[model samples]
Target: MSDLYLSMGRKEGAAGSLYWAIQFTNTATTACALRGYPGVSALDTSHHQIGPAATHSGSSYGTVTLAPAHSASAIARTTNGPVGGPCLRTGSYLRIYPPGSRSAALVPAPWKTCSGIFQVGPVNVDGTF
Candidate 1:
């Protein structure tokens, strides 16, 4: 997935939920298509997986196509309450995999996450916030 670049947008919050917009840009010269939910999870400073993988929270998913220099996005949410029990850990990074992709990208994120109950939406075409 070197042809694609992954980036996170500003965080938005309402009620008791925190939301993040994950953007995937096609940096190559050609267009590409992405479908389903992107794999997402917290990571320890050592790069090991932490907590349960983010669960799919949205309804049905649809294919997201991107043209060169264009982008697609997905939304991820986390609760304000502490996660996990006494073993609750702070994550130093976030590991992400685009829809139908095996390769992944590591994003720096300082967050305390529980070992359960992570949530993420399905990938959507460009301009989706």
Candidate 2:
């Protein structure tokens, strides 16, 4: 995990749901493989988790082998709560645990979610999703 760089790609939305591409780039000299869904959660200003961790979505858990400088990505989806609603909260950042890794990476993601119920897809080769 130390050899991987994590970042957000772009914001996408449909209906009332929000999506973000969680990008993982191989920064090592050799290749690495990432499979399954990454662990994701929203964090507040104090770095405390807002709610339960993201649930896994989809079954496309194929191994994504990334060579140096290559990238893989996972899609995270969540729904925003009504303004001033009881379930609404603004997350200042996100805590991401790469597949098969115990270490976590943090990325800035100021977004709102209803109870932090995020759905994340498995990692796939770049441009495949």
* Candidate that scores best on TM-score: 2
* lDDT of candidate 1 over 1-129, digit per residue (tens): 899899887787666566788888999898898888889998998998887888888667778778999988888777655444333487888899988889999988765554345688888864343
Model 1 regions more than 4 Å off: 83-87, 126-129
TM-score of each: 0.87, 0.88
The C-alpha local distance difference test score for the whole of candidate 1 amounts to: 0.78
Give the lDDT of residue 70 in candidate 1. Answer: 91
lDDT of 2 by residue, 65-128 (tens): 9999999999888775553335647888989999999999989988566644578889996533
Top candidate when judged by lDDT against the true structure? 2
Question: Over 4 Å off in model 2, which ranges?
Answer: 80-86, 126-129
Model 2 sits at a Cα RMSD from the real structure of: 2.4
Q: What do the candidate models score in CA lDDT, each in turn? A: 0.78, 0.83
Worst lDDT 10-window in candidate 1: 79-88
Which 10-residue window of candidate 2 scores lowest in summed lDDT? 79-88
